[model samples]
Target: MNVRHLIPTAAVAGAVVLGLTALSACSTSDAADRRPGDKLNVVASFYPMQFLAEEIGGTHVSVSTLTKPGVEPHDLELSPRQIGGLGDADYILYLKGIQPAVDDAIKLSESTHSVDAAKLTTLEDHGTETGGDEHGHEHEGEGAGADPHIWLDPVKYAEVAKGVGASLEKTDPGHAADYRKNTDALVKKLDTLNTAYKTGLRNTATKTFITTHSAFGYLAERYGLVQEGIAGIDPEAEPSPARIQEIHTIAEKSKATTVFFETLASDKTAKTVATDTGLRTDVLDPLEGITDKSKGDNYFEVMQSNLAALQKALGAK
Candidate 1:
């Protein structure tokens, strides 16, 4: 998380270019660009937040994301310009514990309209089983800071959507009606998604699924399935031999058929576990960010693809 110390002094210009490339890569407006508009400048922490802002704020807001597309968000280190650019935002939306740099930068910025999505929805510690690097770990004294991946759960995400809508209404009162309408539409879509997952996964041959990243805890719990993570919370962390053996036992006992991995993270762990267990490997995207490699573009499409993957893995009848 100490990104500043590692910033290379020799590649300042290259880093700037890389940063510019990142800014362009997400295909969102830059918060720092001086624009002649009354549109609210909304800076999002990442795709999940960005999606909500775009869906809810509509034409009233110009949204930008700190974490670029295709990049894993946990290790996201903000450039100095990106950090300073936070002050230019009319409203900022972020989840507190996921990105350390964004959290620190937002706290230091003078943006009063910043909204923490975690505050809008209740967070549950799905524990380390389905946890990943940032969202799934237990904090020392902070009471299991709850999983920051609430956006993965449609119901929970709907809650965050309502909160975001209200916040935007408060920020830009002139567009309150539009924000409310958009929020309702999004929530309705989420409701339909929730129903689909419920019906699709209700009668599965297995209730347990194995995964390399523990990013699907909420989704699993929501659909009455169990998640066995090869690596707890941190995707880069290697599984201990005992843990690997335990997964093998669990996979067999629970009749698990697939070892799932994310689009952004390395699939080696998933493949290794699947190969050893004689189970198939499949993509069960956590829906962190959309990329060319993603099953579908945007949240709803990717989530539908996720539902299909889960149904296939669990052998839904």
Candidate 2:
């Protein structure tokens, strides 16, 4: 997928504002001078979230990313100006724990007018709904209970897109109809993609697979697949020696074809596991950032790539 093809010129225009000088100014007053009809001020935590907001908000919204491209969302620290952007935003979309600085800024921005996409979308409690117990919690380690990467899963992202549209409509009620229409269209696209995954991955030759982290809980639960990971909720957490040994044993016993790692985190541990088990390593992007090699510009292409990877890994036709 060509990213340039997926992104509209308007989306590219929005990204133009994210230069070093703009990021350096990070002042609320600077954002305030831009004028109201110029665009609805919106801030998204990372790439996927930013893309969704841009898709739904369209020309009516001017979207900015709180976390810069190529920067790890888990390790992001916000500048005072970035925090001011959140305070000035009509809506701020972010995964709860993926960027602690964003989360903290949202708390502070609440004193003014701003929307919290996570709470508005009710994504924080997904584990319980799916019969999974891996609830998000705060930790000093990399993005605990905040699996801010939920947008990687198409199904979850559809819901988030819907929430973003609804929130935008609320903030700018004049454009509510357009927002709803755009959101509905995007949701239909997501549904089609979801069906493709269900048909492509269900009842495949391989049922068990290993990942570097536990980020796929929503996707696994959505498709009746199982993913065992070397680490826990936090990708930064190292597996216990016993846990690593257990994963190795499981992979050997299950004849797992490949071990998957993500783009945002280090692959050293995953490489070690693959070497120990003699399994091939494959990428399963968490959609945290857009790499030069990424198929397309936004989350949809990344998700399609993920499905293709899974099908290959699972030995599906």
Candidate 3:
């Protein structure tokens, strides 16, 4: 189940900035214990990163997550113990900017073997209706933030898998072959998922789908669809009355039949918008965290559920 227990405490700043790096007090090349399959201690910032670590690292790593199941990741605050444990990890995986506290702590980490998955792929602004640049622009410069939810897009997530595999190989040369093989396998699965999305959404009645947050920008861009978010990239941001009215018009004009809310986030906004727009509400998990309430157990299963929901909402042909 890979469930993490919540910790309550203040963060002790300074840990982790991933540059395709390795970790641990032991050296992989010379350690006899590591040669005998001593698992690397890995810390993942959240579910998406945790999934990558578990699937790609396979039997070579012991993984733990900072974000507990069913918890809203953006609201996650790290306890000092959790932050302190980062220094002991052989590898740390996290998507920068998704969890602000973790991002702040990772920026301070001295480890060179850590990986920021966001750096492995391209990120674009999806422009939430609440407030953001609607035009797809590069969020490269300082003060211009890019969305960090790239895992939702299979194509982009595969790019990250390649980077992580290469990095893991360098860190653990003894198991380099295993890491490479696992990475290829994971990427192949992602490729298959991408093909399915392309075929399923190709003949949809409408390209626009309304969502509570703008987490699916990369997914929408990859699939040639439009995502109209009620709030900005920040999931908790309240939509103004004007923005609500704007969505009503958008739903009517675009023929959007559903309002999608995430499992972790509150469905209040989605229901309100759906009620006002004469649209039905459904689940469109962002894959942030999986729980019993999620449509399916793992990343692939939940993503498939999302596909079915989108298919129905978009009236896929």
Which candidate number has the best TM-score? 3
- The lDDT of each candidate is 0.77, 0.67, 0.76
lDDT for position 71 in model 2 = 78
TM-score of 2: 0.79
Q: Give the residue spans of candidate 1 off by over 4 A.
A: 1-37, 129-144
Instruction: For candidate 2, write residues 127-233 as lDDT tens digits.
Output: 32222322232212223233344665677778878888887787777778989999999999999999999899976776777787656766876787767766655
lDDT of 1 at 11: 42
In model 1, state the lDDT of residue 15: 46
Off by over 4 Å in 3: 1-35, 126-144
Q: Write the per-residue lDDT of candidate 1 for residues 121-216, one digit (tens) a residue.
A: 888765543442223433221223366778889999999999999998987777789999999999999999999999999999999887766677
lDDT of 3 by residue, 121-152 (tens): 87774443121324442221112346677898
Which order, best to worst by lDDT?
1, 3, 2
